[model samples]
Target: DSFKSAAGSQTAKVQQVVTSPDGEKRYWFKLEGGQASPGMGDSPEPVDATITQDYETAAAMSKNELSGTAAYMSGKLRVSGDLMKLMQLQGALGQMPTALKGIDVDY
Candidate 1:
């Protein structure tokens, strides 16, 4: 249940800090392909990692103009979570390809 615990911890952080356009913040990540689904009733809540960037910045990053760490530090991306969990996730994510599906990058 490590994944669940990780997800729960992340959900708590997102709920505490993120908000939607109407001032409501709620989200979840759908784990499809590459990994098994956590199963019904065991999925983690979603979160939005907002990246404040224009098309150019996005395009550049998409083309590998910046590394993930660099993007984060430069304000191209922002994330919220338990620092430990976040770091763990980052390590996992570092093993993934920058691009997923048709998206420029996984972010």
Candidate 2:
């Protein structure tokens, strides 16, 4: 899958929480040994990092319209734990837009 290829040997468990008017949506992106996948709800395993942002910010990031670093610097995103690990996963994260191409998503 595109996600696996994008992961490319980088290993990390990342918890992403997106807040919206309805509520919060939680997802876990687990990357290991050149493979990666996402799961809904809380991460079963201890995560290397957690990122929380509003729905708009999350959508922007997913669409590649906003960079994580930029979001964090602008106070639109919040990150906790293992900052270096999250920083290292930027390449993998940057692949999100390409990886999700053609998927039908409302937001």
Candidate 3:
């Protein structure tokens, strides 16, 4: 996936969660270059789970430089609604595309 910068620089895929439901648990996963669609938010329909985190922090966690549990303890990450659902979702999220490889961003 390509992430097009406002300045016209094309970056790698940076998955961003647009919305998530509260009860039903819905998640939207859009690759940077992928098309945007509606109904991305959480819904009443049952789903595995949903989690939202800062992109940079997620990258760090993905690399094992930080731990989700640790971040939560440090108040670096915030989770709402179902706590167990969030823990269960962690495994699946760790397998997704969390890093924007080869993409240069000004930190």
TM-score of each: 0.39, 0.88, 0.38
lDDT of 3 by residue, 5-91 (tens): 221221122222322233332334432233322244544344333445665665576565787778778866666555675564444
Q: Which regions of candidate 1 are displaced past 4 Å?
A: 1-28, 31-58, 98-107
Kindly provide the TM-score of model 1 when superposed on the true structure, using C-alpha atoms.
Answer: 0.39
Model 1 lDDT on a 0 to 1 scale: 0.40
Per candidate, the number of residue pairs that clash is 3, 1, 2
**Residues 1-107, candidate 1, lDDT per residue (tens digit)?**
33333333322212222233444333233433333232222225553332244444444554656655776688765665444544545533333234232444443
Top-lDDT structure, candidate number: 2
- Total clashes in model 1, counting residue pairs 3 or more apart in sequence or in different chains: 3
Off by over 4 Å in 2: 1-6
What CA RMSD would candidate 1 show?
8.5
TM-score of 2: 0.88
User: TM-score order of candidates, best first?
Assistant: 2, 1, 3
Clashing pairs in 1: 20-24, 27-46, 28-46
Which portions of model 3 miss their true places by more than 4 Å?
1-50, 88-107
Best by TM-score: 2
